[model samples]
Target: MNMSRRKFCGVGLLAVISPLGFPAFANPSARVRVGVLKFGTVNWELDTIKHHRFDAANGVDVEVVYFAGEDASNVAMLAGDLHVIVSDWLWVSRQRSEGEDLTLAPYSTAVGAIMVRQDAPIHDIPDLVGKKIGVAGGPLDKSWLLIQGLAQRDHKIDLAKEGEIVFGAPPLLSEKALSGELDAVLNFWHFCARLEANGFRRLIGAHEAAEALGASGPVSALGYVFREKWANENPDVAMGFIKASAAAKKLLADSDTEWQRLAPIVRADGRELEVLRDRYREGIPNRPLADEERDAAKLYAILADLGGERLVGKASQMAPGTFWAALKT
Candidate 1:
């Protein structure tokens, strides 16, 4: 058979045989069920993977299940309804500390930022003192902790003590900032991107705060998390999924055409779309896994100190198996 025909037949056969187990004569293609937020930014890459058949190219069938919220996805993950889920490594670390066997492969380094109206008087962290600050993700938000850590370390200013802090959802906080009810707002990356498009300026980014607090480089706050035991048993499938993910990221990084195609689903246009695309591209994790892990260890220490037992659980340091070492290549 010709190459194209053979490839088509292979895909067809794999789909048919996947549920019954691979026949001895054919190469196996594993099906990986991934759970993700319904409208999360991760969808951009996942859509790229599907559009380009990256999963099939890498010997896996990618089945994406959408969840409404992180809590729902986490519940599905723990219930074994998902083979993988996009989540923060810190939560994976906490799970591991609590005797779960989860491990994470770095996904994105895109973190939140403190935003202010373009003409707001806040010029630096110290200026945030005595201002009405709207913070998303509540008291133990990692970005908030990092910013707090930087303030305390550098200027000896306690943000939580000095500022009138109000915690709320990212959208609500963003609206409040826009309406001038807040002097500054720290919000999730996507919201920050929107705020940037709307003439808001970043007072400080989470990445900058992380760097100021001694992280070696841009550390990925989020990743594809799955049980280590499952990955070990299905090494080829795990590697294949990781490969597909990387391929999707590369497509996103290289092609504006892909972004154009994604515009509708991303539900953005003009400057908002442009800012979102650029920010997402910027957030892609390009550092070596070893470097990322090292930075994660350092940041974990800082967060543990600031967020205490509530954020990190019983672990004094990041658990050894927190980052999957097998995907290093």
Candidate 2:
């Protein structure tokens, strides 16, 4: 983690500076406040947890605050407006370095895949050289870093200069690829799943790439993060949230029929729905982060290589408490 102070405060820095005097969160009995993005697969799990009263049944009262995007959510979390949110551990790690005292829990092992057109000339990672391969998320994106690892391992090529790389929002990547404006796309799993129904071929999954590149075991690409201050004060609520999420995952992982039950959230039907369901099924994690040392190592290594100090910072390893095992039950 080679992140410097200025480079580290790259996004919404003004917001985090004010949390110093933001009134302390004084809830004697925990009324856990969580935040979420407007849409994503995590929403479905959160929904199931709510509809089934998984949180309540676990004796946790939870309030979910939905945000427009990550920036607002990050601001709120740092300001102590929210206790917990699901996100990449990179963000949590950076905040922890800055003294926010955050901790992480698992949310998903499922991740998006790299894909190519059915008739594309590229047959392997090296074939991607000099081709127009679109990527979603910014440079520090997980999928992008995973692919960089693929290149670093097999082809010994720097993908940044090796290909015509287009980075933008996820929808634009799919739209361009579908219109033949790009040769292939590395995109969100949901977007890649939809493309599969249209005859797109999977190249490699983010998690699969990390494992093949020398991770300890299968690892999740996303997880839940919460302020240690809140989690410390109300350990039961924190543990309840974890158990409830695990329960929701078990429900869905054990039954594909549960996908149809979430049709409104899936937002697709027919063959497309089937593809998404199958992709999600394929992504369920077999264990927790504590068990994925190699996977975590690869994640930090890849991010360090691709994103430099901007993402991983100067540390040679993931920050302490990046994965919260204290509440593991």
Candidate 3:
């Protein structure tokens, strides 16, 4: 970090150029800067991590930087203001291709679902035909692309053309779907949980779609990311963060008391609490990425086919460092 920004960029490859080794995690007291969104279930897990002192227990001091929105957090990361951020692989792959050297470590596989008002007659992909469907992340949303890919693969239907699509914010999507302005909707797990709380029903979920799409294990798309150079230099901090998060995930899974403690923060109550917890249980991956895993690769392929370079950028292949192969090591 002693070099000026221009000098750092002039070095070409993102590999660390420091002759002196970066601080090792053995010291146990150094804090790793981590960024977290202020809302959503990730916030709940992070709060658990802090409240339980998971970072200190693992011999790494984690400095949690809170961002009100994911976009602000992403901007903070790109500006080199933080060590890690939770985001999807599509952004990581696109950034890596642009010489940013970002890499991913698995977190949760929790994803969105296709939901409809309780009274709606729609039941399956075919039923979506000629109906107005509300979408949270818009046309290029990875989950939407996955369903499109699944439909094309199994039923030979193109959802992009078969349904009337409405793109809007998650809150608006929920409001419209509930008020009957939209016949159905696709929203992230958290949004879907609240929808179910309000009597909306899922027509399909990501887990089911992943299984139908031939994903080998849990279909993981989002995770924690950091610069490859920084991780290689601070090996212990990198591994400690991963190990500590895994612990928090396990705790969230096994303890009802802990779930109760986190309920208010996660915005769960009554039946919505059950819905969110079930989504959490389903999302924890059985294992991190291994050589044979193709979930991320398949998503990339689907996005490419659906949206082309405009969405995924010009990377013709999966970025080499996109999935940190070292987590399982």
Tens digits of per-residue lDDT, candidate 1, 202-277, equal 9999999999888888999899999998998887788778777877777788888889999998999889998998
Q: What are the per-residue Cα lDDT tens digits for candidate 2 across 287-327?
A: 54457534686578667777888777767567777777563
Clashes of 1: 0
lDDT of each: 0.86, 0.74, 0.76
RMSD of 1: 6.3
Q: In model 2, state the lDDT of residue 51.
A: 78
Q: Against the hidden reference, what TM-scores do the models get?
A: 0.90, 0.86, 0.87
Off by over 4 Å in 2: 1-30, 327-329
The most accurate candidate by TM-score is: 1
lDDT, candidate 1, residue 278? 95
Q: What's the lDDT of the predicted structure labeled candidate 1? A: 0.86
Is 1 or 2 the stronger prediction by TM-score? 1
> What would the TM-score be for candidate 2 when compared with the true structure?
0.86
